[model samples]
Target: MSDRKSNDEAESLLAGLMRFTGQVAGGTLEIARHTATMTAMFGEGWVRQMLLHSMEPERLEAMADAGHFLRDARETAGLSLKELADSLGLSDKSVLEEVERGDKIMPLELVLRSASLLARHDPVPFLIKFLRTYNPQLEQVLEQWGVMALPRQYERERRFVNLYRQHDALRGLSDDEHDRFIQYIDGAAQLVLDVMQKEKAANSPPTRVPKRPSPARKRTPRKRS
Candidate 1:
């Protein structure tokens, strides 16, 4: 009888220990899954930040040269400096000006916005060009991690891949040819902007004239005296 009682107590303790171990294992798995989800969502941004913090001096200068392309593209698109700066959510136009002048490192976010707006919503070419000029090391990092490939793949699969195709056609242009091509794009966009302005003026409501104030009587001064 005593021996039976001892066996019952031993079995209960063993069961409790096994249950506790299982619960701990389950909790660990849940934590790991949550970690992975967070990493997938934010890891690239974190990596980019890290890379930006460690940029080399020569790369920084090259970035200034790369930045002129944004100015060229913006002008080609017929966008005002303020318009592009506003689209990038900058508080001051000078911030964007500095970036274009290469007085500042172009933030990754700025690059994306500039590329998208200047390239007619196709950001791949500008992104590749800018990164190659601004930070080849970062470009290599993104390529190795498959980040760069994503945009190219997206461009290839997009319904408007014609833009991408057009860019590809210009890849072999001599420097002078490229400049002429840019001039052509700029002229076309400027023509469109002019047409749009004319249409806007034609369609706008006429300005309302303000009511003129009645003239004060000359006798008012004599009355006051």
Candidate 2:
């Protein structure tokens, strides 16, 4: 290989290494912290990113989904990144630079606030971008670590699968027991769907309640000294 080609490859590899380490150091913020409480289900990983980062994945995928989202917000309000950044006391150029180089990482609350101020929408979508930036293995490993995610959950899942199979054991259940069995299965399914749907909706659009103005209060005239 030519020396120049070798140098270029080395540079790319180093950039990737730096980015990866940057991500790992940032992993607590990206994956472990954000994904707490519930582990992913679909065989999932930020569904949209999972596709592109998935390989042959997507420059075609959800990239436009969010940019378009942010763009509309920009146009609708006739605000430029600079204008919004100035409003927030930030350097207009830095904001654009981050967007162009795609290095924008901010806390969730700040992202939302910035999005609202800039786009008239929440900035939470940056979350998908964050998750997409991470390696999902970190989340799985962290979850499998420590007391909070004790193997007990996996064990319980295994046991539940076992019980569910036993619950289905008949050549077919007798009619009376069959109805109860169906109810059990149906109820279990509904419970799972309910949990998943709640989760999906939760992850979708954030529900923002604009701060309400405090109620009016009557003021008494000044008392004489």
Candidate 3:
């Protein structure tokens, strides 16, 4: 009788675990579909936010100076507090004022939108500075990844890859699952970088090649002769 009861309990637990795993798999698939449907810029922005959200809660909370970073980015973008608030669709500018003063955590959605809007000002660098300030663990990981020697252009991609690895580890993905998802993330990051490069090139002013001084009028020597 005891053996039968033990077997029944073990089977029930195993079934519950299977159900939970199925739910997680289904949810992941749905999220992947939705994210894949987003335009490149928006998709990359979403991925960046996902990385930000993966930070340890305690570290995130201690990020009191995040407001200062936001304020600096806003100033660099040449936006007034009210202007930024309006752009972010916030009805009250004072809320943003509070955020700028380091009194509040920036909402996740706001972080995503703000990062996109502040692209010209290099929001990724701002985020990296924030990480360096508040999260030593992430800095150590970045150091391990040889972040310093890499050119500035690839910083966003490297940071995203690192964060995606952290996200996978947190999710307890199997080795095979991690390998597959990481490849996808790498492709997405490359796509984003390509788009950004193209856009930058398109918006750049045409290079004006200096006209050679028409061989300085060879006839002048003939006239002297």
Candidate 4:
């Protein structure tokens, strides 16, 4: 009688576990499908075709390059293996090796040191580099089509991607709301572009400096990279 009871309990537990697993799997798929539908609906205008026909290779390359740059930047900071570990409150010499090689997930402290030591005064450039490198084609496409078009384009894309990913939120919105969201994307892109272009032009180096009879030789703008 005890043996039979034990078997029944085991079967009951297994059934519960299977149901739990199925729910998790089902929920994840539903999320992905919703995301696809939203993007298909709003990845319109320039990236509509590109998004539908987007390639992943360029993205992979950009990420890899950014990772390599991060590693190199750390090395260039003159941080010794032991020193970086000390900075990270780690004592293991091999730890830095693993972090640099991507063999292990670098801890937050280590990443902070990397961002601080390598990126120094500004880490934003490194990020922009990653974006530019990882999705060169997309970057190129965005640059050519919408980059100069408006900052709103960037802003709209950012928000739309987020909203579309939030399954709970996306599921709640009606079709009309989705259309308004798409329109926001278009308007935002134009607004951002117009503002950025104005800022760029106003601050740009004067095409011709007022002629000074004994003018100092015109200084060249230093390249950031």
**Whole-model lDDT values for every prediction:** 0.66, 0.52, 0.62, 0.57
Q: Best candidate, lDDT-wise?
A: 1
lDDT of 2 by residue, 61-106 (tens): 3334334444444544567777766766675556543443333333
Clashes of each: 0, 2, 0, 8
Task: Tell me the RMSD of model 1 versus the true structure.
Answer: 26.7
Q: Per-residue CA lDDT of candidate 3, range 1-225, in tens?
A: 999999998997678657645654564454456556653547665664664476456545445556766776676567999899889898979877766664444554566677778754455555554443233354445555566444355555645544644543547877898788879978997999999999999999999999877666455544654
Off-target runs (Cα >4 Å) in candidate 4 are 1-63, 93-95, 104-110, 127-225
How should the candidates be ordered by TM-score, best one leading?
1, 3, 4, 2
Give the clashing residue pairs of candidate 1, or none.
Answer: none
TM-score of each: 0.36, 0.28, 0.36, 0.29
Candidate 4: Cα lDDT at 3 = 100
For lDDT, candidate 1 versus 4, the one ahead is 1
> Residue 29 error for model 4, in Å?
16
For model 3, the stretches where C-alpha displacement exceeds 4 angstroms are: 1-62, 129-136, 148-225
Please say which candidate is ahead in lDDT: 3 or 4.
3
